[model samples]
Target: MTKPIRKAVFPVAGLGTRFLPATKAMPKEMLTVVDRPVIQHVVDEAKAAGIEHFIFVTGRNKGVIEDHFDNQYELEHTLADRGKTKELEALLRDLPGAGQTSFTRQQAPLGLGHAVWCAREIVGDEPFALLLPDMLHLGARPCLADMRAAYDRHGGNLVAVYEVPQDQTHQYGIVGIEPERDGAYPITAMIEKPKAGTAPSNLAISGRYILQPRIFDLLAQQERGTGGEIQLTDAMIQLSREQAFFATRFDGQIHDCGSKIGFLMANVAYALAREELAGPFRAELEAMLAKG
Candidate 1:
């Protein structure tokens, strides 16, 4: 039997200093995009891609995240008593069910590599996905689903790539590929945030990935690379030689939800997508735009 790609890791350990006072009392992932928190969208995407187990690598002051996924007895009772079944169902929905989700604390700000390594025990020896909760992506199909299709066919590492401006290559992991098949490339190497005019390719690694379990061993060394933190890209590069990696262009419009402006943009974009709120939201946005 084929091993199930049932587990996923969400790295939510960042302090979210970029969001300042708003995040001071709450986790950044809890920030709402329209009516749902940013992490909820990420969780929904994972569920769409056939993921059954949710593993969160969290840090301090992240209890709210845990509470959000758990059953709220008082809230459910109020909804049931008031005959608010529709709203209650909507609110209570989306959890992965009892015993299907778990959390592990990182306990330090080591970086993405360390964050992924923290979930090592839960992940075990199965191939799984890593989703960045801070990136809000919208597509006809979920971004994780896009990568999973490629992963099942190619059977190794897959990183979602998108075309970024030449000057912005220093902001992401750029892929160097040897075209292997349709819509997939055999990764020759990866340059993590290369200097301007030195990037291997403009196809930058966005926020989604399906990685092999072998990467856990490379991350075990835990040597600090670029940015003076244990970079996940570094470990990925080391594992690329032993197997193969692919860069698949994800069909989505990604908004960096970690930044202030990006957060506002995501809210506006998502609100416009809602039927009940779209009319008012767009009218307000148009008035704001007209005034500006």
Candidate 2:
């Protein structure tokens, strides 16, 4: 029987240097997209995908993230006392259960692989999902849920992939696939940021992953790649050679909230997609465009 992916590791230890002054005081994951923080959106997606344990690999000054997931007693009491049923219900809806959440500090800015390794004990020896809080995937079906369905059928390591422009292949980890089966391709090899014109395919690996525990072993000895940091893609490349690895092409739009323009676009897109905000937001946006 295939081991169920019940836990998810979120690597949010990055010092969001790109966002500068704002990120200096607060983590990029805590920045708001629409009304909810970016990390909350990722956790909600994982919950929708049936993830039971939420393990966050955070860094220094990231206490706000923990507090965000915890119950706000004072605020909840205030809302309840005022008879604001809807507000109270909304606040309580997304908070994870007491024991369902875990937080570990990465201690050093090593790399994604190192950050994931920080959650090794909590993740144990089971297949787990890894999600990057900086990437928000919006779709009719949750991105991780679709990846989980693929993982169930294939019974292997699955990486959520999406097509990127040929010129942009160098910006992501690219994969070479065998044949397309059920919207997924058996990943033959993984190339981390391939050089221009040398990429095998444009199927770029996104932030979502359903990785087996064996990967943890590989990451432990992985050598730094690219920017002198342990690259998870490098270890994954080794795992693909010895185990089953597939690339599931996700049907969604991924907004890279790590960058300024991308963060702005995420706010605009999510706002425009909301039922209550769409009409007004679009009108105001069009009015601004007309003025320009």
Candidate 3:
């Protein structure tokens, strides 16, 4: 039987050098897509997927993320005093249940693998989900939830994948997969940022993952790869040799919020996703395009 994926590890330790001034003091994961922070969106996905514990691997200046998930007593009190019942309820609704969330510091800016490795103690020995906060998935269902379902069907390491333009495969961790079988593909190989025409397949590994605890062992011994940083893809590649690997092609729009264009696009996409804001937001976008 497949072990339940009860915990999720979120690597939010990256310095947002891409966002610069805005992220100078603030963690990029705290940046808002619509009204919710990036990390909150990812957490919401994990929560929807039945993940009971959230393990955030954080770095310096990420305290705001911790506070975001925790209650703000003064704010709640003000909302109550003002008779803003709806606002207060919404705030409380998002808070994780007691002891459901854990934070651990990743002292150095190593890489994705090291950040995930930092959460080994919290994740323990079970299958766990990993979601990158920067990759916002917009769809009828959360990306991680879909991955979780796939994990249930195929009990092994699974990575969410989506096709990129063949020419652009070099920009992502490309995966070679066997023919699709029941909405899942057996990942035959995973190559990190292959050269332009050297990619085995156009399917690129997205940020969502359902990994076995054994990955922690590989990450612990992982050496720096590609850009002098310990790449999670490197460890996953090594793990694939001994374990079955599969890919779930997420049926959704994934906005890469780590990039400026992607961040702006996510705000627009998420705003359009909201029923109350869609009509007006679409009109505003049309007007802006007309003016341009």
TM-score of each: 0.96, 0.98, 0.98
In model 2, the clashing pairs are none
Which pairs, if any, clash in model 3?
none
Question: How many pairs of residues collide in each model?
Answer: 0, 0, 0
Reference-based lDDT, residue 218, model 1 = 91
lDDT of 1 by residue, 1-292 (tens): 3355789999998999998898998999999998899999999999999999999999999999999999888989999999999989898777679998999999999999999999999999988999999988887788888788778777888888888888899988899888658668888879888989888889988889898898899999969976788999899988887877888886567889998898899988888778899998789989999999
Residue range with the least summed lDDT across 10 consecutive positions in model 3: 222-231
Global fold similarity of model 1 (TM-score): 0.96
| Model 1 alpha-carbon miss at residue 146, Å | 1.1
RMSD of 2: 0.9
Candidate 3 residue lDDT tens string, 206-267? 89999999999999889887677888998999899999999998878999999999999999
In angstroms, give how far residue 60 of model 3 lies from its true place: 0.7
RMSD of each candidate relative to the true structure:
1.4, 0.9, 1.0
Per-residue error at 96 for model 2, in Å?
A: 0.4
Per-model lDDT: 0.89, 0.92, 0.91
The prediction achieving the highest lDDT against the true structure is 2
Measured with C-alpha atoms, the lDDT of residue 196 in candidate 2 is: 99
